[model samples]
Target: MNKRKYEMTSRADAAARTADRIIDAMLARFATTPYENVRIEDVAADAGVTGQTLIRRFGSKAALMNATVARELARVAAAREEAAQASPTDTIHELIHHYERYGALILKTYSEAPLVAGLPALAARGRAFHVDWCRRAFPLDPSLSPTEKAVRTAQIIAICDATTWRILRFDGELDEAQTEQALAALLLPLLV
Candidate 1:
């Protein structure tokens, strides 16, 4: 019985690992491809699993996408927590590093949220996460009136948003250091 239990535990562990791989592959695709354009077979190939196995694991494309988004959201939440704990300059560095990694995925999902089922909620959740992150990263005094706090929050969010990063990094052709400087320039003043 002990040997049988050990074998069952090992199989379950392997299955969980395979599921994680499939979700990771789908996330990679979702980062680059439009949600509707992501193919299950391609994801399966990327995960080194058969398409049938993916279907068996996730039941449907939507389920697979949901699992992928959940995993990514958890990752971003943890990163945001760590970034908020850093010093202002370190936070900026952390924010830029995060944007460099997940900016495309965030923007792509937002661009398609209007057209895709289940995306509007995800987009809203992402926005809420950003709002909460900004509040933590740039806290205003409790003595301030609600209106003042609201205005300050908006400025911080706009200054540190991924779109602003794209404008500075891609459109303006700024290097990472310049991009970081620009973000800090816009953000630190508001915090002070």
Candidate 2:
């Protein structure tokens, strides 16, 4: 790569690492405390950065939360891709397993806090990516049309997005395995 390109890539990598640290710290906090109780200063302290530094890097608390949500979704997408390559038919299982691992904080933050209420655009984009992921990850049945596949992908994603997980886990009192079983039930028809 060219010098300027290399420089930009390195800077981007550094920024991503910093953001990852912040997200990890935030997740640790969210696991024990409610999102409303956690402040930006607390997040900064947990991440080993100054509040000002976090503001400079992530702008506002909303922005930081959005960035963290986006990062987790990206990680999910990456994991899904890797798992899909190995077991296309079982990619939903991999996705559910991944969710069981890193999805708690995401489900809590977006659901309980108003900080992420302003992230509709980001959420929409994430949904679009999810539809594509579902289409690719799930093995296509010979009986399904392309249009049917597209619609089913969108529907499944709409029902099982981050928000859904929060609702199911909190409101419905469904544990991780229950959530996975429900999703697998909905997804199995598509795979067949």
Candidate 3:
């Protein structure tokens, strides 16, 4: 690359590193305190950066919170992918298992953060990701038309969210094997 382009890229990378540090600090604070009320100063202090630095990188607390939520959702997506790898016939079950393992923390973090109140957009991204996964995992669910398939894909994604997992696991206390069987049964209508 040209010198100017290289310099610009370097600067962008530096900014991203700063933002990551600030967000990491914010996440640490969030783990212990309510997200809605955390001041910028606290995040800056936790991150060992100046308050102005936080503002410079994230613009506002709301924006920073959104970034953190997006980061977490990406992690969730990766975990889902890893889980799906082990159970090729039942991607939905794998995703639900992933939720049982990790979804609650993300839900709690996002729900408690006012800045992450725009979660519908995040959900849309998640829905799209699930649709993509469905296209890959079950390309021929014969019962579904194209439109129906898309809708079903979205529903499966929502069903794998934290609430459903908690309902099945915590409320019902379904053992791991039982939960897997239940999810497989529950998914039969869509998958078969």
TM-score of each: 0.91, 0.66, 0.67
Error of 1 at 102 (Å): 0.9
* Candidate achieving higher TM-score, 2 or 3: 3
**Descending-TM-score candidate ranking:** 1, 3, 2
* Top candidate (TM-score): 1
Q: Whole-model lDDT for model 1 versus the true structure? A: 0.87
Clashes of each: 0, 0, 0
Task: List where candidate 2 sits over 4 angstroms from the true fold.
Answer: 1-19, 109-114, 142-186
Better of 1 and 3 by lDDT: 1
| lDDT by residue for model 3 (1-192), tens | 999999999999987888888988877776667766789999998888999989988888878877876897788778666755654445766666676655566567646644465655775676577657655554447666889877776666555556666777778898767766666666656655
Model 1 residue runs over 4 Å out of place are: none
Model 3 weakest lDDT span, ten residues long? 110-119
Question: How far is 35's C-alpha from truth in model 2 (Å)?
Answer: 3.6
TM-score of 1: 0.91
Mind giving the per-residue lDDT tens digits that candidate 1 earns over 80-140? 8999998888999999999898877877767877765575787788889998898898887
